[model samples]
Target: MTSSSTQHRPPIGIITTLRSSLPFLFFLLLLLYLISTSKLLIYPPHITTKITCQDSNLTTTNNHPKTGYDTELKHIAFCIAASSKLWKSRKEYIKLWWRPGETRGAVWLDNQVKIKKNETLPDIHISQDTSRFPYTNRQGHRSAIRISRIVSEALRLESDDVRWFVMGDDDTVFVVENVVRVLNKYNHNQFYYIGSSSESHFQNIFFSYSMAYGGGGFAISYPLVKELAKMQDRCIKRYPGLYGSDDRMQACMAELNVPLTKEPGFHQNDVYGNLLGLLSGHPVTPLVSLHHFDVIDPIFPGMKRVESIKHLLESTKYDSGSLIQQSICYDMKREWSVLVSWGFAIQIMRGILSPRELEIPSRTFINWYKVLDFTAYAFNTRPVTGHPCQKPFVFYINSTRYDELRGQIIGIYTVHRERHPRCRWKMESPEKIHTVVVLKQEDPDRWLRAPRKDCCRVLPSRKEGIMYLWVGHCGENEVIEV
Candidate 1:
């Protein structure tokens, strides 16, 4: 009976049977392909690769060994990018901040750098070859590819107990204590990119508004760098035409979907000429890293670039938290607007000015683009004008010391050059005042709380041709009024 039925059914046609099973076959093949592809792609540094579960014991900001403690010198690993040819001159800048054995990080050079005798610089390490990474930027050097890899390369070294990895150029002078203070705000256990953009408006427009200028330096949290190291090369390859390591690093950050957590304290200093205006009116934040020391004029008017930075560092030593911090007070009797940039300069505006006007930086320096127009600046700038009401007589810091017995920092700023300013108002000229003295108490944890400008009180001058001010937190009822 089965033979007869089979004969009547006329042996199922092979073509018809194949059609019914094609859908299942296609589904099976697609699933297999995806599994194989994922297996191969998982090991390579893809932008989206998640390595969290791969290393369960990996330390995070919250789980870091010293998580509860504030960030310190040892917790940060700095990767300084330098060319072997330029290392000789740049080492001086490094020597300014790199505390041997205490500061963690390395100076990455292109070739073997001959360490000078008694050179107390960070350990010099040659960068891994980056010729394999393609770069077609007409205006930028190919070495940017190598420099961009510094963060990943640094991570590969597996520095111990590192909560964050900080990157900077060899010429970048870091206010390390201040940097630690600023970084202490964010959680290093999470993916955080801490830095600021360039001072040049054109520069930001040309590269990115969010890209952290590598010269000024940027900090990457341990968790982010661990992830970044996994896929940075491939991420770099995806953008060969990018200008510098900064934009390349930024490109990777873009893929990670982590936006720049801008800390204004990280100054790119993308300007040339006198840094007086810039430093004197620095945003009411801690001064972190100062970049482009090689390009701009010496920070201190009369000193060499190195000497100027060291000079500024002198004030940093006494009260790093208050270094270049703008504290405004009025010389009511003299009818003068006083701006005390503690440890930097004390600008005595000839006429009483609103604190708002003092807050805007003087455009004493030129933009990086060399554009003469005011629009080139990333920030608002008050022209260094002849108007007595707006003109500032900046007295650069001549000497600063910690008065241990007084529990305060005594800073004396002397006129670099006495100026004869025009003011028909018959107001007593600040030019008559030869020196400005500021006493700032050491507030070791000033940055731990929300950042706000410190208040300054104009105390009576003990001697003629002198002015004294006590700089500290604003009183509940106190206000900087003209």
Candidate 2:
């Protein structure tokens, strides 16, 4: 009976079998649809489907370092304010510092400049549009009135991809790398009014402390630029009394409720003196911009302005932080006190320690910089004693120009000290050291060394730390601190 029932069971309807299996077949088709639409099994998927942890396309205004933002992926636009009268004086500086595509914004002026083929003059000429804003007698006032229009035009002409819009004067020299670094430090998605004060406290007082010196240059984020473009004209109309472009900018920023994000690297250079005190004391930060070189002295004591700038570029290129770190000026105390200024150290006490008493040879003299003092009563670090009387005491001079030789000589006097075993420690007259300067021309990455000759002598290597013989033309000026 079981065999007969089994034989007859499946000879039953195909419709019945199909109906029973429909649910599983339907589930399989649904799974396939989901896989195709969701791209689950696809190899080499599109960007949205790929596992991406970072947005490599970062902008200056949208970057947040903690959020994996990179402004290097973006570009910056520069808006420069210049008068037709001062074009001659400022053209060289523009050529020296400004890059074509980076500084692509217009240079607001009354006339057109004769630009050479490779030379990058301002991208646009902002001639006096008397219809927009009438020309005025006060040049400063005129520039103040023109700023809003200039900024508006720059915002319009620059590619939407531009992340930061910087406003500067004809004299402003931008260290674009440092500027980018500073800008990258903050989340540019938020409004940023970044700049530094003038060198003179009085200048800052005359203007508002909140104001960004036009010469030093200031940066505005793309979002801020859009906001500024909207209100800039109205803001300028409100500040009719403001004479300087910087003051007007400050007034507008205040109206916008955007405070100055003071960046010390943006030097206005309104005051004249050696910058050694400031640069040496603070070496960690980058120097983004420097302005008013015509009024201020060349960075180094004797360097010409152009030479000083070239040296600064070369020094920074060679070692970005070393220029500031190595341009040290400090005083160390011992029985023989030493004053070190701008890489130079001088022994202040004549008879502090007798080399003969210490049993060192007289003819084999030592420069005091070679010595280190670790006695309970003495400062831990000082220059080691080294022979200074040797012929052709070779120094590798990395100067941009010839005028720097005098400064280097003066710098030598500031830190020069000698010790001799045969001599009594007397204040009378230290032995004369004949020094020769050798210019550095080889690769900056390599160690600087003078060609050896029987007539040429070099300082002995110190056990503590060897003093670097190569000095760049742009080294900080001598700053003697007690």
Candidate 3:
């Protein structure tokens, strides 16, 4: 009789069931969040483990004040990746230049490098996992795969002891002291990925603008390193078509929502030319590392690449000061102008220049009220070692007349020098006169009035197939190569 009266119960609505469980779900998630943030301590008491080097010579400094902050608390591990092809030169260079006494490092190899049994190297060895990638040996794609494996291995080693994981090519030069100093600026407890772009915009276009060009080397904080190691194998597998370790690393970072934090001290040297064009002007930042010495000459003046590097190391020994004062100057063939009051060279492109003066000492000192595209422009400073311009040439284009000379190359050079230089103003037009003046010791009128003067002519138009920034009217030799 009860069965006859049995009625089908109304089906429970999904929304109603979800709503009923919401409180419990929320509480669970909140607990996880708290634990993840280390707010709710569920784990056992953490032991403050001190990192000790296996070698007595390797002393890990925990805190040093002169670096402007405490950095000894963190340990930096370097993973210098190398190919067997470059084994001889790179291994020797590492032994000669790289000082691993303060930090931990290892050389990752794709193949075994033959070295004398007595010869001590930075524990150089190839990846034990011979699982071959689709990419051929020495190809950048394969290099990227190897780097992922290297990073995975590095993370597995003494997890708590490693605060930072640095990756560099065999040719890369690391100023460990400066690297430590720069790392000190950021909290090691947080996730950080530091690097810079290649000097070549084309390479960036082909690969990725966000990537820290591998040549300049890069650093990953311990927290980020752990996160990366988890997904690295999967990430590498996905980027089968990508090239360059840096580019692939960037792609993986994108998936993890990590951005490249640019540090100017890391020189990609993607551009072709003497670095004098770059390093000369007093760079305000400290020089942390320089890469691609294989392509260009070394940074230090007047020595072979290796010797120059050694010389640089000696000069900055125990010194945490900035490499340059931000007065660095480089040459460009593009249209340029000078700011009279403030010492700056304004390169004229499609963008308009700000009429006002920005700052003295160097452009790096003052924030640009308006972007004038001044990096390519040259100031009074000479990056060239021998010809150090004591009283550098400075000039200004009339901003009111900027429209008239929008795309014209302007060159300024030291004609002759006096201890206390006088600024010279030359008016080229009446409505908005184009002006030129020296920066440092200024008496503009006196120099213009002087019959005998150093002459520079930035022609209004290009001649034949070539354009010239004529400095002293003496044929091609006097022509300043933009």
Candidate 4:
């Protein structure tokens, strides 16, 4: 009887133990599911990856080791106008013919113009006389044609040694530091000409328009100059009666499939006028030259053009020392001010939404929320309303996750509409009220909305609702309890 009683008791005890452990097992499984689904817990610090060449040999090499031109490679060649017409008075037509250095051009070619320590100045040559050309009435076109001829002669003179020939208007102001920097980037063996390239436009009916180089500035590589010299006669025959010689020259290069690279911060439009502020802040450090078209002013009588060049050369001594330094400081201050304003706005927005914890999946923590926060912070301080994806406040979340979170009200914060004038306010649901936990009294006011008696409600059957939260103001009047 005792043995039978013991067996029944053991079975009953085992059954009781299994029933007690069921609740604990169920709770453990639920916690595991929540941990698996939360994106915020899984990913952090989402970073974009960029591809770069891995070869050690791909690194940039410095070519310009010495101050001046390498004797082995003659690079610089001067193209001076041999027979240029000079006006006697302010309103007068050409009264006398002079060489490049005889009038204002002479001031630029003076002893003060020295080549860099290691850099070499090429053989100088003059352009052919314009009297031989059929188009004598158009002085602008004639000058451009003469410059082209000079470029041809320079290429021919030092055919083997030189790689580039620089042609400039007599009144142009050049910064040698800028030119040397560009020359240093390439191995003297490679050939590439640098200049501005723009699509052609037709402004007047009298002229048939086509793509051309801007008249103010340009630089040609040694190979390009050589090719142009070889094709000079053919270009003249192919494009007969071309309106602008510079345009025609560019067209010739285009026909040869020679691509032009742009060198920014090298040339200035004002030859005599000082550009203390503009060149200093440009991303490109070195500037090549300045093209001052109106250095000889038609407005002021008795203003000798050579006198202006001399004054400008003297002014350079003062500007070179302090002008760039001051401009850089000013630019830094402006950029810092912009960053500070943006940081302040981000702090305010974060403070307003402090009550809510972002409930994202662990996998999405780094990729989605972090990116959104960064974007929102950047755009909030801008003067104008930023584009949706471009601004800091707006972030791209997975559409599926967004859809799940759409109806859920997570925090109380202010919303402002900047660009749109006539925005309509509509309550989506009358039955469902959203509870906004405010930390301060003035938070809702900053958002430009009136206070309400009850916390905002979401209508049970309705699909959408808009609600805002106030910080510190916990009063019945301040709370919108819908």
Model number with the top lDDT:
1
How much lDDT does candidate 4 score?
A: 0.33
Q: How do the predictions measure up, each by TM-score? A: 0.83, 0.57, 0.54, 0.39
Q: Tell me the tens digit of each residue's lDDT in model 4 across 218-301.
A: 567677777778887566556545666556666677777866666643443321232221222222133345454354242112
- The lDDT values for all models are 0.81, 0.52, 0.52, 0.33
lDDT of 2 by residue, 351-466 (tens): 33432122111112111222212221111112234533211111222332222322222122212232345544333332332332212211221111221101111222221212
Ranking by TM-score: 1, 2, 3, 4
Model 1 alpha-carbon miss at residue 320, Å: 0.7
Using TM-score, give the best candidate's number: 1
User: Over the stretch 1-482, how does candidate 1's per-residue lDDT look in tens digits?
Assistant: 46676467544587688889999999999999888665331121121221111224333334444323477878999999999998778888999998987888888888997776787988778889988888898988999998999888888775699999999998888999887888887888889998998898998988889888898899999999989988898999999899899999999999999999999999888899888888888887888999888888887776898998888889777788888888888877877788778888888776667888888888899988787899998889988876655567778888887755546667778887845556677777776777776766677656654577888877654466777667776656666655
Weakest lDDT window of 10 consecutive positions for candidate 2: 448-457
The runs of at least 3 residues in candidate 3 whose Cα sits more than 4 Å from the true structure, single-residue gaps closed, are 1-69, 117-120, 130-132, 136-141, 300-302, 326-482
What is candidate 4's CA lDDT for residue 374? 23
- Ten contiguous residues minimizing lDDT sum, candidate 3: 396-405
Clashes of 3: 18
Deviation in Å, model 2, residue 256 alpha carbon: 1.1
For candidate 3, the TM-score is 0.54
Give stretches of model 2 more than 4 Å off: 1-68, 100-104, 127-140, 273-284, 321-466, 469-482
Where's the lowest-lDDT run of ten residues in candidate 4?
A: 337-346
Off by over 4 Å in 1: 1-69, 388-390, 421-423
